[model samples]
Target: MEQDLGIALPLDYKELLTRFPGGVFRRIEIDSPVANEKAWTKYKRALDELLEILGDEDLEYLDKVDYTPC
Candidate 1:
């Protein structure tokens, strides 16, 4: 279930995903660095869940985040 992405996910992210199966990530348009970080900090758990699903090999429980098609 591992590919060589060469990027390390933040600590506790996996745990958060495992704990909350309903979590999700919000694709941020980082126009404002301070605001984006603050928002991300508040929704860190959701981001972790999104990462978990994206990284998971099991498709049974994996759910993609909803985004508008451009």
Candidate 2:
């Protein structure tokens, strides 16, 4: 992942994410893919599940969600 990103993600971040692999503070997602392949895959799968279960209205802010690959 660091090789793909051309940079090393902070050890602290990896540690935190490892311990708590889901959700950020108050459950707000950052809207951008991280420097980790597993994390990004998990996010996309979650979004797809949300859309399937909750429908399009749940994705109203998708335009505001950024997708610039790291």
lDDT, candidate 1, 2-70, per-residue tens: 122356655576556445444334864332212345554546555567777666655644356454222
Question: Which ten residues in a row are the worst by lDDT in model 2?
Answer: 61-70
What's the true lDDT of residue 52 in model 1? 72
lDDT of model number 1? 0.47
Clashing pairs in model 1, backbone N/Cα/C closer than 3 A: none
Question: Which residue pairs in model 2 clash with each other?
Answer: none
Please write out the lDDT profile of model 2 over residues 1-70, one tens digit for every residue: 4564467989987777666645466778653346367767766677668657544544565456555222
Compared with the true structure, all predictions reach lDDT values of: 0.47, 0.60
Model 1 TM-score? Answer: 0.28
The true-versus-predicted C-alpha distance at residue 18 of model 2, in Å, is 0.5
Rate residue 16 of model 2 by lDDT.
Answer: 70
Against the true structure, whose TM-score is highest?
A: 2
> Which residues of candidate 1, in runs, are more than 4 Å off?
1-33, 36-38, 60-70
